[model samples]
Target: MKSERLELSTNDVKLADQILESMPGFSEKMLQITQRLLNRERQHGRYIVRDQLARGGMGVIYTVYDQDLRRTTAMKVLPPQILHQEPKVSSFIEESRITAQLEHPNIVPIHEIGVIEGSSLPYYTMKLIDGEPLTNVIRMVAREDPDYVRHYTRHRLLDIFLKVCNAVAYAHSHGVIHRDIKPENIMVGKFGEVLLMDWGLAKYVDADDNTAFEEAQDSSQIIEHNPSRTEDGVIKGSLAYIAPEQVLGEPSAIDKKTDIFLLGGTLYQIFTHLPPYEGENMIDVLQRAERCQYEVPSKRNPRAQIPKAVERIILHAMAPTKDKRYASCQDLIDDVEAFLAGRRSGGIRQFRVGQEIIKAGDKSKETFVIISGKAKIHRSVNGRNMTIAEIGAGEIVGEMAGIGQGARTATVTATEDTETLIITYELMLDELRKLPPWMEKIVFSLADRVRINSGYLHPLLLENRIFPLVNQLFLIYAGAHVQAEPDTPISYPLKDVVNEVTMNLGLDMASTTKVIDILAEEGLCVNVAEQLSIPSLQDFALFNDYCRCKMDINTGVKKIKEIQLTKEKDSCFRQIVRHLHEIDV
Candidate 1:
C-alpha cells in the first residue's frame, strides 16, 4: 500500500481562502470542510489557532497550540472584522500591555503578544485556566445545587473575595483602577485558584479617557442582564455593580474607591445570590445605583443568613458617598479579615432566666460574650449537675468548643435574665486559623489540661505549671527552626527542653514532664530516643493557645466575685426606647 501526502503551496492556500470568501450560499457541509482546512492552514506566529473559544465585544478568543513552548494556552485576537476600528485596536493593545505589567498570582498572566504573519489580527496568549466564571458558580448557588452549596460555603466565598482584593490592591498600588469588576470577570479554577479576569476597562489614575468601547474591549463574552455600554458621555461599567460615581459619568470620580464599590457589589451577590441593585428596567436600575439604593444582603434574601459583620462591611464599602466608603482596599480588607477572624463585636441577644445557654456534651461552637446579667456553670459530675461557678457581665462561655476542642465540657444557664453577643462557629474557626503556630499549641495544651480535670492541680501550682512551661517550650521549638514543614518533626534535647521549661516556670520537673505527656497524648508532640520531637510544629502551637485560653477561663472564673461592673448606659437606653416603641408608649 502506497500512502501519498499532498501538501498545498502558498498560492493554493490563498486561492482557497478567496474561493471560500467569494462563493455565495455555499452548502453547510462544504463550508464546514473548507473552513476546517483554512483554519488548519492558519497560524499566528508560533500558535496554531484550533477553535474559537469565545467571541467578545473587543475581540475573539481561541484555543491555541503553541509550537514553541509545546503547550496549550488561550489567545485573544483582535478580530479582522474590527481591525479597521482604531479605538478597538488601541484598547486591545492597552489591555495586553496593562495585564502584562501587573504580575500577580490572581491576575491572568499574558505570555506573548504578536500579530498573525500574513494578516493584521493582533493577539496575545495567556495561561489557559481550567475554570469557570464565578458567575456560573453564583448561578449554581442561586439555584441551590447541593454540591455547590456545600463546596462554596460563605467562608470559601470570603476567601475568594480576599484574593480578588489582593489583586485589586496590587493594581491600585501600580496606579491602575479596574473600572469593570464583576462576577463575570472572576474565574474560579478547578484547584481553588481565584483569578480576576478582564482588564480592558482599566485606567491609569492620572489619565482622562472616555471609554466608548470599554465593554467591547472586555474579554467576558457573557452579556449580562443590562450592561451599561458607554457612549460619548455615559456610564462605562456593568450597570448592576458600578459605583454611584460611575453613574455620574465623571472621569475624575472613578478611582480606587470605585473598585471598592464593585468589590462590595460582588460580595453582595455572593451572599444574597443577586446583585445589590435591581429594578423593572435599565433606567430604574441605573437610578438605584445612582442613589446607591439597595437592601442589605439579609434584607434582600433572608434565607441567606448573612452575618451582621459581613453586612456592615458591605454597607461601609458600598456607601453612596465616596468619602463614606472604605478609604482604600487595605482598609476594606482589614474589616473583612477582622470579621472572618471572629473578632467582631456581635449583635446583642437577650436570654430569659433559667434558660440553658449551653448544654454539656453538645457539639456546639458559639461563644457568648455576656453583656449583662449572670450565668451559672454546671457540670454533670458522677450523674449530678453540680454548680461549678458563676459568671457575670464581661465574661465569656462556650469557648472550649469554639476553638475546635470538641464537645461542651459543662452546662451554662442564666442565673438571671441575661444579654449576650454570640460568635458563630464559622467565624471562630476563621479566627483559630489565624493563630500563630506557637499560640495554637498553647491553646491546645491549656484546653487539654482543663478537659483532663477542672481541678487537676492546685490552682496556684497549675497557674505556675502551665503558662511559664508552655511559653518556654514554645520559645525553644520556634527558636530551633523558624521554617520547619508541618509534616516534618523538629527534634530538641529532651533533658534540655524539660530543664528550660521547668526552670522558667519555677516548677518541679515531674509536673512539667506530665504536661509534655498530655501534649503527646493529644498528638501534639512526641518523646522518643531522649529527644523532644514535635510531630507537627503547627499542631503544637495550636495546643499552646488552647492552654492559654483555658488558663484565662480558670483564673477569670475565680475572680468573677471581685470584679467591678461598668455598665454601658447607652445600650440600656436604646433597649428601653426600642421597648417603648414596640409597645406604642
Candidate 2:
C-alpha cells in the first residue's frame, strides 16, 4: 500500500524551468519569426496570414486577416506535400463546404470555403475560437490542479454537458451526424461558449443512409462517396471515442445515435477525467472501443464524488446497441436535466400520512424516492422503538433493500402524507446498471452499518448510543442540504435531522423529538426559529465514542453468554458422572 513518486533529475528540470522563464512566449516568438521570414503576408490573396496557430494531421491553422471584411479570422490550409493528390484535395474542399453549410450556435460556422488562388489547394476561414479544447479541461481535472478544480466543478461540468447536448440536438434536427464527438473536437470558450469542432468526419444525409450525394443539391460540394474516406474500415475520429458502428463501418448505420455514443464518451471524460478506452497504440484502442466495453467512471475513481444518477445517464447514452441509446440527443438532454433538478425517472405511488410503507424485516424489493412529504424511520431496539432518521422530499428510503442488501433494515412510515417514486428491484437495475461495482458495494456496506446489532443493545446502553446516533444523523442532514465546505455558519432545518435520525436508528417520532430537544438544551447544538446548527465535525465526535462503547458492550455481552452456556454444560457433565458412580456403588 506504500505510495511513491518517480524521481526526476532536478538539474535538467531546473535548467528547463529557468530557460523557459527567460523566454516566456517562446512558441509565439517562433511563430512570429516564421511569419516574417516566409513573407506569408500575401500568401492567400485576400486573407493575410499572420501567425501559424496549429498543425493537424491534415492541415495547418493560421491567424489571418480578411482584407475584404477587415477582421481577424482563422484559416485552415493543406500542406503542399499532402495537396499533391487531386482526389484528396477535392475531398478536403467538399468537407469545408459541408461544414460551412450547417449554421448553429454550437457548430463553428464557416465564413468562407474556398481554395488558395492558382494552387488548387482547398482552404477555409472560420471564427477563431478564444478558448481551449474540452481535452485541456479534462487534463486539468485529471491533474487535480486547484485553480482548474475551482473552475470546473461538478455542477459546472454538467451544465457544460447540457449545452453540448443541445448543440448535438440541433445538429440532429438538421440531418447532420458528427461522427466524431471527442473532447478534442469540442472547444470551450472562457465565457461559457461551447463549440463543436472538426466537422470533417461529419456526414450529411438527404434523409437516410441510402441518400445519394450526387442527387443532392450540394452535389458538387459533396465528395462522391469513395473508398478514400474509409481506409480498411476506419474513420476520421480517434479510436478512443469513435462509435461501435463507426468502428465496424456498419453501412448506413451512421446517424444521430452514433453521435450520442460519442457524446457519452465525451461525458465519460468529464466525469472520470479519462477517455472511455485507452491503449498503447491506435489499433489497441480501436479494438477495445469496437468491443463496446468500458470501465464505468465510478469504478475508475469511486472518490471522484460524481453523482450516481449522472453516471447512469452517460452509460445509457453510450449503450453498445444503437437502439439502446437515447433515441435523440434531446432525449439524453432531458434525462440529464431531470437528474440535475433532483428528479428521477420511474413509476410514482402515493402514501397516506401515518401509513407504514415499509416494516422492519419485511422483504425488500423496491426503493422509494420521496417526491413530497416527510417520513419517519423506526426500528426496535431493546424492546422499545427508536428513530434512526426522519426523511423528507428528495430523499430515498428502503434503498438498502432495493439494492439487495436483504430484508428491510428499518421500517419507514409516513410522518405526513407522502408521494414517492418506487424504483423496484427490476427498475433499479436500469438505474444502477451503469454504476461501478464499488458504488453498489458502498450502498451495501452502509446498509450493514445501519442494521448491525439492531434490537440487541441493553436498554441502559441504548440511550447513550441513540443520542450520539441522533447527532450523527444531524450531520448527515446538514451535509445533504448545506454547503459541503462551508465558509459561514450553516443552519439546517430541525425537521430534516428528525427524519435522518429515524432513518438511521429507527427511533419513533416521540423519541427523536425528545433527543433533539435534549441536545438543544444541553448546549450541544443550537436551535433558532426551528432551524438548527451543529458546529462542523462536532456532531460526529460523540457518535464515534458511542460506537467504541457499543463495541465493548457487545464483546462483554458475548462473553457473558458463553459463560452461561459453559456453566450449564459443566453441571450436566457432573450429573452424568454421578450416575456412573451410583451404578458402581
Candidate 3:
C-alpha cells in the first residue's frame, strides 16, 4: 500500500459507489471513497483535472478543464520526489516561465503555473492539442499504402518541418534552445497545424554570450547508497537525435548548432522513415548518437527515392560535429526552403535522339537539366565537330549562357529521347538568388574562370575539359574529408566516386575514370596499395597544389587569337554552373 500509487481509476470510483449501496457497515469507507472522487472532480483553483493523458520521468500530463478560460487544456505536474529538491523544483517551474515567454505559433502556449490543492505537485496548464504527435505522422510516411506516401510527399513533409524550424528559430532569438527536438515531441494537427511540445529540457542562454545555450536537465540514474548522478557521457536530450556535443556534455559547446543537429535529425527521419541512428536499447542509441554513425537516406529507405539535393541537405544539417552543421536555425530553414524552391522550379521538357538541344556560336537563353535519357557534348575544332563527352540523367546543358554572356559555346544533342528541366532566363534568376553566398561565389568564380581559362586550354585534349570538371570534385573532397576525417585519403574508392559522380555530379563513369587516371598520373592522387582510399593527407595536399597551379596556368594565359567558345567548352561551363547551383555549397 504505497500512498504515492494510491490513485483511483475511473471504473474504481463507480464501483465504490455501487458497493456502498449494498454494504451496511462501510459508510465510513464510502465517505472516504466519495471524498477521493470529489477531489478528482473538484477544481484545483479553477482547473478541473479530468484524466491522465501521459506520464514521463519528469512529470505527469493530464487533460484539464479551465473554468476561467472556459476551455479544455493539457496540464503537466511535477511529481513530489522531484519537488523535494529546490534546485530541481526551480528549474521545473522555469519550464513554464520559459515556455510562456516564447509566444511562437508552433510552440504550445502555457496558460497558468501553480500547485494544485491537496497535492504539493507543481503543475502548468497548456493548449490541449487535438492531433497525433509527429511520431505517428512520420510512421504514416512508411506505410504500405500508396495514398499515404502521395499525401505526405517529400515536399509536404518538408513544409511541415519548416514550421518546426520557425518555432526553434524563434526560441533561439529569445536566448533559449529547445535541447530536445524530435518527432515524438511535436504535434501535427489534422488540419496542417504543427505545435512544438514539451519545453522540459529547454534552456535559457545568458544574454551576454549569445552563442552559448546553457539549458540544464537532471537526467540522473538512481544508485544504491549514494546520491543520484547523471549517467556519464549521456546527454540530457533524446538519445535518437541528440547532438555529439550534447553526448560529450560540453557545456560551452551547446548552442544554436546543437539545435541544428536535432533539426537535421528530424529531417533525416522524415526523409528515410527511420531515425538517424537506431539501436536495440537506450544505452545503445545513446552510444550511437555519441559516435554519430548513420546511413544516408537512400540506404535507409531505398524506395523513398529521396533526391540527392534533399539528401545532401539533411546530411549536412545533421553533421556530427557542431561546426560542420548550419550556423543558425535560420540558415537551416533558408537552405531547406531554397532546396524545396529549386525542386519546384521550371517545367519539364522532352527531347529526341540526335536533336540539337543547344549549338555553339548560337545565342541560347535557356539552361536544361536532364531528368531522363542522355546527351552528347561536341565541339567544332579546325573544321570538324568532335565528340568530347556523353552525359545522362541529372546532367545540365546550356548553363554557360544562363550564368554569363548569352552566347552558347558548345553543341549538345540528345543521345536518345530525354526529359529535361528547362530553366529559362527568369527562373534561373530565382534559383540564383536562393543560392548561398559561398555557392554564388563559386558559380561566379567558375563562370569567370571558364571565360578566362578557356582561351589557353585546348578543346582537343578531352582530358583538358575534364580537368575543370574534376577540379571541383577535388576541392569539394579536400574540404569535406579534411573536416570529417583528416587522416584518411578523402574516400577515393573508384566505385564510390564513379557512382556519386554519375548520380549527382552530372558526369558519366567513363569520363570520371579518365579524370581520376589523369589525376593519378599527375601524382595529385594515388590509390593505396591494398585499400580503396587514396594515400592520406599528402595526396590531398598534392591535389590542392595541382589545382592552384592549374588555375594559375590557365587563368594567367591570354588567347592566342580571338578564339570562339567551342560547343564542348560552353556545354562544360554550363554543366558546372548548373551543378554549382543545384547542389549544396
Candidate 4:
C-alpha cells in the first residue's frame, strides 16, 4: 500500500495565519504545526483536503470530502514530527479509541479511523460541520456587535457554553476527560447548533485499573518519550487551555475540575477575545495557568458587561483548587442555566412583565410574570377574538406554554412597562419546588383567580349570560366556606356580597342587594353584626344544597321552604343535618 497524498491551498495557509494571529502567543507554534500539516498533505495522496479548519500543537484539521462516503468529513491528521514520537502516537491512539465510544449530538461524531499506509501515522474522520469556531465568532461579535453581545438580554453566549458543558459533562460521565477545552474547539453553526470538537487529548482516567497489557502499553510509551522530565515529555495538550494540575505535570491528578478550568478559560477568551495570560514562553504561560491568577472576566472586557451570574460561573469553573470549583460539569451547566434565567445567588424572584415573556403558543424561550402592570389574556377560538381574562400584578402568565404545553392557553402582552420575573422552564420548576408553603398557596390562588375570570369573561364575550347572579352568589358562598372557621358563623357584608354578585354575574349591585334584603325580610336569612347569614339552621342547610346544585335563586328559595317543612316532622335529624352541612360547607 502507498501513502495517500493531498494538495494544500493558499486559502488553507491564510486560514491558518488568521487563527494564529487571533491566538497571539501561539503564533509561532501554530505556524510550525500548520507547516507540518501541509507537509503531511503533500505526502498523502488520498484525502482531498479542501480547507484548513483549525490548527493546533498536535495537528491540523481539514475539511475533506470522502469520495467513498460521498459526504464532506473533517479529517484530523497528526503531523509527522508528533507522529514519529512513540508517546504522542500512543496518546493519539488512546484518544481515538476513547472518543469512538462516545455518542452524543453535541460532540463531533467520529466516522472512521485510518492509518496512512506504509507509515504508522494515524488519522480519523468525523462529520464535517459547517460552522465558525466559537473563538472567531465571539471575537467578531465582540468587535462588531458589542452592544448586542453585552446587553442583548438573551444570554445566547451562556446558552452556547452550557451546551458545551453538557457535552463535556456527558464525556465525564463516560469516564473521559477532555484535557484540552478552548474556544477554538467549540463550533457554533448557523442555526444555533453547537458542536464540541477536538477530543485528541481526551484521557480515560479510569483506564488505569485495566489489564496489565494496557498498563504496559501506556508505560512503555511514556518511557520512550521520557515525559517525566518537564521539557522532555510529549506535553499532550496546548499550553493555553491546560489545567493547573496538567501544568504541574501531574496528569494523573487532573480530574473533572481540569475540564472545568479549561472551560472557564474558554469562556474567558470568548468574552475578552484574549486568553487569561499572554507570555513569550510556554514556561511563563504554564506558570500563570498553574498559579490561576488572572483579572476577573468583567474587568478584562469592560464592554462585555457580563452579568454577575456569568462572572460567578467563570470564577467557580476556574477555581484554583479542584475543591473550590464545581464538583462536575453538570454543576457548571446548572449555574449557566441559572444565570441565563436571571437567577444568581439571591432570594427567589417574583414574576414581572416587559421582559421577553412567552405565552402558551409562543416558541420563544422566555417566561414572564405580571409584576406591576396589567396584561390581558386571550385565547383564539373559531377564528374569533376572545378575551379570557385581565391579569394584574402578582399574577403569572406563560406557564402553560412554558411547561411543555405545545400551545399557550392564552396570549398575554404587557399593558404597561411591566417588570416580570423571567425564568426558563428548567429554572422555574426548580424554583417552584423550593418555594415555601405560603408561596405555593399564593401561586395556586392566582391560578384560581385566572380560571374564574377566564370562565366568566368567555361567556360574556359571546353575549351569553352563563352564570347568573344566583350562580355567582353560590360560588361566593362556597369560596367563603373554605376560609371560614368550623362551627363559627361566616358573614359577608351586604355591600361586599352585592359587589361580588354584580361584577361576577353581570348584574347591578342594586338588584343583588334587593334580592338579599328580600331573603332577610322573609326570615330566610339574618343580619347579625352587619353581616348576612341564614337565620334558621334548616334554612341554612337548604341554602347550602341550593347553592351547590346550581339552581335559580327563586327555585333555591322554594327548595329551602320545602326542606324546612319536611324538617318539621323530624327535629333531631334536621338539626344534625343542618349542623353537619354548615361545618362541611
Highest lDDT scorer: 1
Error of 4 at 566 (Å): 68
- The digit string of per-residue lDDT tens for model 3 on 1-585 reads 655756779898999889888897699876778766555444446787799999765788999887656789999988776677775577679889999999989999998888888878888988899988877777876774556655665667788899999999999998898888888888988788899988877787653322222333333331111101122223467666778787766667788788888888888888777878766655566577778877878788986656666777788888878778888888888878877677455688888988888887787678899999999878766554556678899988777678776477678999899899888665565455445435666986788678556534343243334435455556557666767854554555667766676566554566666666655654445655522344544444443344444334355243122233457644544444344323211
Question: Could you give candidate 4's per-residue lDDT for residues 1-585 as a string of tens digits?
Answer: 899878898899999889888888796786678767655445445567789987655666888876544578888877887766776677667766777788888898888888866776688888877777887776676666655344322356667888898999999998888876888778888777899887766777765521211222245433333211122233544566666676666656777788888898888776666777666565566577779767898898886555455667788888888999888888888877765554532223443454323454556534666557677665556555555556778887666444443444566756566666765665554444334435645875675566445433434344322225434655566566668786566677877777777777664454456556555655556776678765454454554554434323343344332333355534543443344333211
lDDT, residue 328, model 4: 84
Off by over 4 Å in 2: 1-45, 117-119, 206-234, 345-355, 358-382, 385-585
When superposed on Cα atoms, how far off is each prediction in RMSD? 21.9, 21.2, 25.2, 20.1
> How does candidate 4 score on lDDT?
0.64
User: Candidate 3: where are CA atoms >4 Å away?
Assistant: 1-44, 145-147, 207-234, 343-585
Q: Report the Cα lDDT for residue 333, model 3.
A: 86
Q: How displaced is residue 81 in candidate 2, in Å?
A: 1.5
- lDDT for each residue of candidate 1 in 240-322, tens digit (9 for 90 to 100): 78888887777877889999999999989888888887676666787888888888788899876676678888998899999
| TM per candidate | 0.55, 0.56, 0.52, 0.49
TM-score-sorted candidate list, best first: 2, 1, 3, 4
Q: Which ten residues in a row have the lowest lDDT in candidate 1?
A: 557-566
Predicted structure 1: lDDT: 0.75
Give the per-residue lDDT digits (tens) of candidate 2, residues 314-347.
Answer: 8898899998998888889888877665455458
> Is 2 or 4 the stronger prediction by TM-score?
2
Ranking by lDDT: 1, 3, 2, 4
